[model samples]
Target: MAAADPPSPTGMGFFGMLSFRRSATAVASFDPAQEDELLALHALHAHVADRLEALSSHAQPQGPVLSLPFLSKLLDAVLSSSDAFRAVLALAPVAAAVSRPPADRLAADLLDRSIKMLDVLNAASLTLASLRGAHRAALTAASCLLAPALHRAHFARARRAIARIFPDDAKAGATAPSPSSRTMRALSVSVSKNWSAGRHMNAMAAHLAPPPQVPAAAAAGAGCGLGLALYTMSSVLVFAMWALVAAVPCQDRASAAISPPVAPPKQAQWAVPMSSLQDRIAEEWRRREKKGSSSGSAATAGLLAEMQAVERAARDLNSLLEEIAEEEEDEQAAVAIVSEERTREVTEQAEELAAACRALEDGLAPLERQVRAVFHRVVACRAEVVRCMEHVPRTASSNAAASASGVPPPQHHSF
Candidate 1:
């Protein structure tokens, strides 16, 4: 036999082997029609949701899961719906602001939505791994298209998680002093006055500012070109300032100058300036001095008019009171005469209440029957469900074993 030439690395034979290996791998890993893959992803999602529920029921952590850094990674890996993530995270600050318990509705909703998002991610990841052919190509394209959306979703979820972890503080800080008071104090320091006086002057002084001082001649001479320009400019500035000062109304300057020296308005300044009002008050006071002055001519002249009217009213009131007393006595006598009637009314009402209670009790009878009937139906339904579900494990085991033995599964209903 002729000696076989050494296998050439550059030859078609080597290339053909490499291609075959690659094709085999592609075929093994790709599943374009991966129905089971999709199902598995869904199953995993459901499992995760159930897990989240279990976590919620148990004692809540000091912080919400939404705030967790892991959530950011997980969400980034899986989320595609940016709007959905934002909606959920938006509730986080609200949950924190209310200082609610972990079981609060907003927090629970966030947990539920997060669990759902995880489900979506699990489904997507599985779909990415198992997909093949055109389906794989489509999903890959879709994932690229949705990249921004996924990123935004991750950001929104992260924000919500932060809100849940840090609740708002109702008592944030001490109350600040009023703005007016602060303004007064600032003015007092500026013009060498007390706080009370400063308040009145500050508002008017806003317009009475003094001109800036001129720089010294030596300083001007020693200046660089810019400084010389500034120094030379000083005279022009003084003229401008004087012009501005002259433009201010005389009344404004007078008010501004005097305001700081003024004190707060006194109570008498608030009262109406009328001599008659003072004299009338004094005359009314003098009438109450003597023992007989309480009913004297001076007292009865003007101020005692109302008191005289009150005396007449007292006489009327006493007459009315006597009439009312007689009427009340008559009413009491009548009430005694009708005591039997009231008792009869009460007895009738009691009997009616007893009848109503008996009727209510009777009404519950049918409800009791319904409850029992429902209970039995539920039991039957549960048994049927258990029986149906029980077959699943055995069927799965059998299918697995048959697959291993090169046997086919039994044909069942097809969708």
Candidate 2:
């Protein structure tokens, strides 16, 4: 029975573990020097390009790029192979086009749809890149033509690939201060943190402070009144005249003597609450450790294990919270940009998107004129653009969907 064929790695089975590790291992098993997959992929691209050229020569609306349905597919196949090949052809015009949205609302919508189709192609490219593994220089080179600023994850992966060229930064004092040298550095950091907090508090106080115009006028009037009274009394030099003036009732204005209490800043309100929570948690942990230390070795071991678990949980919670904060900041930033970005810039971006979508849609125009409808949609998809922005928060979800569908996010302009 051949031991059931080792469970057939590529087959669909209930117990199949089709993970990145499995896929990577399978691809690594192949010898790139002997493999023809790279050659085949290139040929496929060449054939597609040839088809495109033929389509372009036609008097029909189809041009070199307007004809190849298999172009993206072939590019995917070539780039996916473990054998290294520079997919410069795929990187140039199509990637630029895929990133843009249409200018007009209707056109933007159409463009977005077309862009999405191309995203599937890119997704396939991502898979191929993943399988091939550690193509840093190639990917970095590709990213120049692809989404450069936005290719952080890719760049990071690329760095990891070429880490031998750039050794990991030193652990002790990489950024951390040496124990002996920590005094000045620690003081500086503490000072900076405290100053920031102080600045925030001061700003809040300023906002809460009452308008000074009223106080200024009141002080001036009071000074003038007192001066005049003193001058009059001095001129008279008569005790009887001063006594009569003092006995005379003046307009009651006691309220001016009292001051309104200033309101505390917004952050100030939450500072106590946050600090208290931290203090309580720290105290609980310290108490547990102390109790364990007082007990025998078994209790101490148990306490240490529990402490370790707690520490891990705390670390995980901190990580999760940090992620949440980052996501919130991203969302806020996107919102701020959407509202704050120049109308002209948005229009330009829309036009760029439209252009790219049109390019791809136009590519399909010859083989499938039916694709022209998609082109029209791409030209008109403003709502879709906004939706895409909203979906930024759900990147993992979108990425998962793209992977499941064997598609990738469209390689486009950073914005």
RMSD of 1: 41.0
Clashes counted in candidate 1 amount to 4
lDDT of 1 by residue, 1-415 (tens): 9755434323222113223323432445363323222232233333333332333333124321221122222222122222222222222222122112211222223233333222222222221122112122222222332232223232223223222212231123322222233322210122222222222223322322211223322211111111111111121122211211121111122222221211211111111211222233233333333423544422111122222232233223223324534654786643322233433432343333334323333333342233233233323433432343345466668889999999997542100
lDDT of each: 0.27, 0.27
Q: Which ten residues in a row have the lowest lDDT in candidate 1?
A: 220-229
**Highest TM-score: which candidate?**
1
RMSD of each: 41.0, 39.1
How would you encode candidate 2's per-residue C-alpha lDDT over 300-347 as one tens digit per residue?
111112122222332232233245347557866433222222323323
Model 2 spans > 4 angstroms off: 1-34, 60-415
TM-score of each: 0.19, 0.13
Q: List the residue pairs that clash in candidate 1.
A: 31-132, 32-132, 66-161, 67-161
Clashes of 2: 28
